[model samples]
Target chain A: MSAAATPPASSEESTDASSPATGRIPGNRAIWVGILAELTEFTLMFLVYFFARVNHPQMFHEGPRRLSLLAGSANTLIMVSSSYLVARAVLAMRQDRPEGALRWLLAAFVVGAGYPVVKFLEVRWNLEQGLTGGGDVFQMSYYYLTFNHLVHTGWGLLGMAWVVVRTWMGAYDAKNHNGLVAFASYWHATDLVWLMIFPLFYVMP
Target chain B: MTALRKIDLAWALLVLFTLTGVFLGEFRQGGFWVVLVIALVTALKGRLVIDVFMELGEASPVLRRLVRGFGLLVPALILVTYLWGPLLARFNWLLE
Candidate 1:
């Protein structure tokens, strides 16, 4: 997510009285459900990762050393920065600024596109270093979890593409930008997951 | 500060925190202190993203709590696992 509403999102934007959002949850009911499911899936996988680490401490410890920390960190910065841009896009729409929102989302797409690019390089590097899923417990967990995240991020990028087109066509005004919010919600959730993943797989000491 | 400016500030802070995490990983090595610090930072960044970026800062109580709970939960779980890793590893009797 990017910025806040310079003012506040008017009440109409948050139509569902049951929604604690008041202007929260960016997207619609459906999007929140997806976000919830995604988070839960990751939570379970992270647990699996922790358990694997516990069982094979030495592997987990040495595994990351062979992986590309620079690539991981670069991706972290890319994810966070893109997430910031997405938030700004949502905020821009809420303030009746479709052009600004569109611009932000475009920037977000460009930034977000970096994730796969970096991951490609990282994977190539890992392969060269012999870090395969079949290598050991830690490497297996790392590959599975990170690859899972990459797949989800691919979905997010596709969503962003749709959002970008709609946004460009003036499909989202301040009065109705649920699409923007919904996409941002997914993007932000992905960012949150990456934040956790980064430390676990790359930066954990 | 404007919301955009605040977000920019948060972005800078997050970047700094991320770099610090990398440096800590490079210099610190595995230990309880490192685990605790990393988890704490992770929790903090999660809260910031939830509160500001996700716009739950002034949201309803339930929404606030949900996001807040998730923000705290991930790191807490990691920290707990880190603290008792060996003790828990003892249960590897079956797998071993």
Candidate 2:
């Protein structure tokens, strides 16, 4: 499913809404709906965190105190850079510059790869300190939220890899570049969710 | 070209500043306010990611509407649930 497999006609350049190509790609509505669904899921998780805090403030504090905000901040920067690179790739593709797009996608893939390594180290350090989620509500929430985020990050890395391979092979162009757009949206949404999660779980006191 | 480059530079600097703030604040004692500011900065960064990086600013009107609707609804839904559901649970009045 490489984007370059389908070359759009020259007439496809118009951004007019009345153009036949306007709604051809999977509508943005679906993406927004997915975002909303994930937001609802996150909200429920947050409500759980809030109720837990109300019931067990000491436990929440003890667990949160062990988190490394340094690693969290580093991961944030990495993901932000990755998003920027992906956006650049999309822009390059829109300008019909496949080589530039490929380079940017590769940059994004490299940054995406760094995230899981940092997350693995964080988890290992936490486990070394006897902070497994097997006991206590706070530990459970910690594992649940962070692990859920880790899973999404893993998927995001894989998606970026796919985009890199496709872009390298001239698989995407302006008209049929939904994969790039979709991947960027998914990756940014993951970051968006984390922007909230990091504060609520790791930073808030 | 200059305008686009400036926008990109501004976004990059904003992200760097936010990251630095978050890191410095994270290690400080009694850092709740600092973290809160970091969160606000983070949300601002998110908007940049969406508007500039994701090109939502140039998105079609229908697409924009969909994004705006979802954005507003998701937060509102959570807040309503948080506010009312807790009250109902405590009083057991809504079920009755």
Candidate 3:
């Protein structure tokens, strides 16, 4: 709920379309390397998804009806909120508000932790509904993609936990929070993946 | 606007777009246009996260474009696949 971070922007630029391109990387350049890798991994998986969907359109259409929309929606909100909180943490660091930044990161971790919990419950519910056969392309894609995402989220949570500790030690400040920024970049990238995944698996039908 | 307010607005829009996507998914069956709209919404959401939250708005043009390209390309791929999936499937042997 705290304010987020960034170099600075005008009201006009905030529209996203008109935002001035300043040629700045958020944290460190290395983070983008990781972010790009993450994107590549998902890109490959998405190709598989598109392939499966094309071959068996009916299964993809019927897949959503079988899964719980509530769970999917809940996970989407959770991922978005987590990304927002981490962004806030980065902003707090920019303002040289270490305590504030720490709080934001902590909040992010708490919220992000909900992802796996919701996922666990969702998986359990899916099993209870007898959706475990993985016989169809849709079901196979659903489990593989979501489960892969869950694994990535788990890595992100670990990173957040470490970043949270680093923030607490006053390791990052206004002029030198590249580590924090990098973490933010990775988390945002992960969040971006989930955004795409939600629609493909849950909402696209 | 303040940086905080800018991202807050972005976050708000992200949530709004997400809920709208879900609403559309819930009420309607799949179609070319519906899927296109959903893909566009998703691309927009990805752009917001990249430019705003990732603070790439003022960053290098190359980096920004690379990430933004992912945002646009994935949705475009989704659309193309949705439209020509069967034909594409015929080329599955290429993967083999």
Candidate 4:
């Protein structure tokens, strides 16, 4: 359970030495590049909305008004707590406390799952209020940004669930925990993007 | 096994409290200021999550550089669009 008892090697070496090898754990660079690409796509969509809002302010207001701040805030808290739990899980794994890490991973997974459920309800409510994506630029941007984040959140929850299972199986020690690390990074990125989107689209004018 | 460092529980609590305040304050007047403050706080929180929670501080220098580069580039691009592109549109430069 000690760091030395676990593979005392770089993440790459430990990843190679493991059973059912999936090649080297993908570097942080590759993951960041992928995330940046996705963010760029989102930014273009936001810029489109910005131009639309500038040209047609009235079209944007109705959709923005229909957004449920309460649900959005709750999801924010959930994501923040989930990120915190993932951090704690990594710390536990570093301490060679597999059971503790597994528990935290499970908790993080639960909180991550809650985000999309809240988002689904919010989207349903917006639809009921006649704010379809086709209605106007604001509705489209609202769906574009929030649903994009929700998709990321769904992937994050699946990643968390995988981390939980692997941690329970004692597959992640200090050296071989890159999967967990990558999952944590992606989850936090999702939270980071939402942190920007929530206020920009929901709280702000 | 390494001994666990004391969790930065206080800083985390501070962030949570600030976010809560921003959420509540949004319901009142001063909407623009509230949104501005919330965005700033959220950025700080994102940094905290990256540095402390994700242990970005402990990562390899190359990894840190990658993050730093992306951080700088992404915001710069956004600001450029907000400033120059909008100004060009205002001046009707694109129409010419």
Could you estimate the TM-score for every candidate?
A: 0.89, 0.75, 0.90, 0.75
Q: Which ten residues in a row have the lowest lDDT in candidate 4 chain A?
A: A17-26
What is the per-residue lDDT of model 1 for residues A5-49, given as tens digits with 9 covering 90 to 100? 343366553543222244344566688778888888888898788
What local lDDT score does residue A29 receive in model 2, on the 0 to 100 scale?
49
Give candidate 4 regions above 4 Å deviation. A1-29, A58-63, B1-25, B28-32, B58-96
Off by over 4 Å in 3: A1-21
TM-score of chain A of each: 0.88, 0.81, 0.88, 0.81
In order of listing, the candidates' clash counts read 5, 4, 8, 0
lDDT of each: 0.81, 0.64, 0.84, 0.62
Candidate 2 lDDT over residue span B1-96, tens digit each: 332463477457657755655654466444445544554555566566555655554455554445444334333433443345445346434335
Which candidate has the highest TM-score of all?
Answer: 3
Candidate 1: residue pairs that collide: A1-A87, A2-A87, A2-A88, A21-A24, A205-B30
TM-score for candidate 1: 0.89
Model 1 clashing-pair count = 5
Model 2 steric clash total: 4
DockQ, every prediction: 0.48, 0.27, 0.50, 0.27
lDDT (10s digit) by residue, model 3, range A1-205? 1123355456565553323335556667677788899888888898888878888888888888888888998899999989999988887777778899999999999999999999999999999988884557888888988898998899999999999999888788877888988888899989999988988877885
Candidate 4, CAPRI quality class derived from DockQ: acceptable
RMSD of each: 4.8, 6.3, 4.9, 6.9
Error of 4 at A122 (Å): 0.9
CAPRI verdict (incorrect, acceptable, medium, high) for model 1: acceptable
Worst 10 residues of 2 chain A by lDDT: A16-25
